[model samples]
Target: MTPHNELRLLPWSGPDGKPCFLLSTDGPLSRLAGLTEAAQLDIAADLLEHAHEVLADESSAPEELRLVPSDLTGALGDALRVAASRGHRLPTPGTSDHGDSNEVPHLPAGAFG
Candidate 1:
């Protein structure tokens, strides 16, 4: 069982769209969450490729362009959620369990406004 502060953030929402979390990291629920997160990431990747194709086409219709943002918005939300969940799991810098000290985290393009 993980400590309260180390709870795993679930990929799906609970009742009424509330955030869900897992206490145990070694169980059926945890496996399911892992699979779900992987699927979400794969879907987001596919959507991104499609978005790029749509955007790069000079003759794309307004209707086609309009739909890309709506789809991208949802994918972005899932990606951000996944990033936050994984970020929380990373060992803090300067901690005993931290990985290579030379590793530096890079922010995504336009991460800061």
Candidate 2:
């Protein structure tokens, strides 16, 4: 699949039961391993940095920025939570399946009854 399509599946639990997703289009991470925990953490940092770059400037994103995963923060995470609670994953770019153009549900009036 294309990098863009591959990225849609990021933050995915890898086959090894690890929480890393592929990025850089350099190939899968299954091939990379070492005897140190720091080595693995380094890989995770690269992935996170790339994720932020893509989200910040979609145009500057590498054409091959494949298999990237998103770790939502702040507003993005809040939106995702509402979506998950109501049974939906990230909305496709520009899609508004819900009645409003925002598609995201507002925090329930006052957030609790």
Candidate 3:
């Protein structure tokens, strides 16, 4: 069994659309993991381009305008996950020890729900 404490960044999401992660000791990246990461980055890149285009369009619909923020934010989060998987550890939000006591507020469970 995979060790419970060994960290692994998940490349896909749960059935409810939430991101999922795993725990496994130092092992080679699985074929599925590699493929998933590539696919996710590709999709994110496409979405980013689409989001920029939507923002640039003078005649964008109200719905498209509303989508821009969520789309961009989601892409950024995905990119962060990919970066984390490559061994760049992101500091835990509230654990920053720079004497800044203002904790970053956690977002509500769902996006704009």
Candidate 2 clash pair list:
none
Q: What is the TM-score of each candidate against the true structure?
A: 0.76, 0.26, 0.56
Candidate 1 has an lDDT of: 0.82
TM-score of 3: 0.56
- Local distance difference test, each candidate: 0.82, 0.44, 0.72
Model 2 alpha-carbon drift over 4 Å, by segment: 1-34, 60-66, 70-113
In candidate 3, the residue pairs with backbone N, CA or C atoms under 3 Å apart (3 or more residues apart, or in different chains) clash, namely none
**How well is each residue in 1-113 modelled by candidate 1, as lDDT tens digits?**
34446888888888899889887868899888878889889999999999999999999999989999999899888888888777777766554344457555779889987
- Which prediction has the highest TM-score against the true structure? 1
lDDT of 2 at 29: 46
Please report the TM-score between candidate 1 and the true structure.
Answer: 0.76
* RMSD of each candidate relative to the true structure: 5.8, 16.5, 10.7
Query: Candidate 2: lDDT of 73?
Result: 40
For lDDT, candidate 1 versus 2, the one ahead is 1
Q: Which candidate is the best by lDDT?
A: 1
